[model samples]
Target: MDRPWGVPSPIRPGFAQAETAVPLMNIANILTMLRIALVPLFVVALFVGDGHETGWRICAAALFGLAAITDRFDGQLARKYGLVTDFGKLADPIADKALIGSAVIGLSVLGDLAWWITLVICGREIGVTLLRLAVVRRGVIPAGRGGKLKTLVQSLAIAVLLLPLSGGFAAAGMVSMYVAVALTVLTGLDYVGQAARVWFAGGPGRARGA
Candidate 1:
């Protein structure tokens, strides 16, 4: 018979668990943290003091572009050098969200993009991240190719929107953003559907201590 996940007993008062062994101060992990750090700079350059200066727009786009590069490089380094750690696995996605989420929200707040579009994109991202964490201990659901493609589209769209461009060029960026939003919603549903299948097949309980 399969074991049941029965109700839990009460925890002892003041009990503390052992610390997980998450390595620190590695180059790959540094790059991941750098991406997170860049989000604030990107926001500031894009929105601070009315964001009208051409120089500021250029700075914002440059910061975002650098952050995106680090995102790609960090993962590649981790995989190539066997530097992957629990902390990297957790922090990396959070960093990506901070970068992309901040970009979309900033654009909307600046009246460059529509609020409804931002709502859909950010909602999907935050919801999926939480869902992934909830079921991660059950089994790892690696990023699919479609998910990577969505990231690429989002990066390009955000960069285009950040640039100080003519009205026509800016409108083109909005078109790209809409395409990204479509992919974001589609891939998010795909992920949830896959997780549901895994749960139905008894995959979650198998990795209780993983």
Candidate 2:
């Protein structure tokens, strides 16, 4: 059927289902499952020791780093192996956010990070995710360039902060913290701006229109 622009609509129900039906059991999905599994282990580590103890904090950070690394590895593997199913596309980022956001909030509660900062970061992450859900159709936002850069920076920042390395590493973590904050703000704004464009284009508000 012709869309408003007289071009055929890009979405077809069967296309996405077909994409999902292919052999999807792959390394990328495995890594995503691994990341999901790490969440509870991370929480357990955080609570196992006194909140002030550096050891537990370091372990939480390390688990966060590994999950972040898996984020990259899974995406690359999916792309390399043609394993990019709709499920993978949807679940990979959500898994990443759940793991990272949890870590950030946990660390903040443990006094590793400032509460407001964690709130801001996590809030933006959730808001942008909802925005994406609102406008996933109409081909407006395809996990565009800015979003990818933001994730990369956020991952690096989180990894550095989680490291048990002392002295110089501590200084590095401080820098990473601020860097992460800045990137989070920029990326959040970028997502909103894009969503606004899509909203105005009848894409974002399509559900309501329907």
Best by lDDT: 1
Q: What is the TM-score of each candidate against the true structure?
A: 0.82, 0.77
Candidate 1 per-residue C-alpha lDDT over 1-210 given as tens digits, one digit per residue, 9 for 90 to 100: 431122122345554232222246667788888999899988889986787578899999999999999987777666655556667777887888889999989988888888998899889888877876876666555667788788889999999999999788888888888899999999989978867766566463211001
- Model 1 ranges with Cα > 4 A deviation: 1-22, 198-210
Error of model 2, residue 48, in angstroms = 1.7
Question: What is model 1's C-alpha RMSD?
Answer: 10.6
Compared with the true structure, all predictions reach lDDT values of 0.77, 0.70
Q: Provide the clash count, candidate 1.
A: 0
The most accurate candidate by TM-score is 1
Candidate 2 local lDDT, 1-210, one digit each (tens):
322211122447778754444355566777888988998898787767665467886787777778778877777666654566666766777787888788788778767778988988899988877876776664335566666777777777766766556788878877888887887888788778878888778552211100
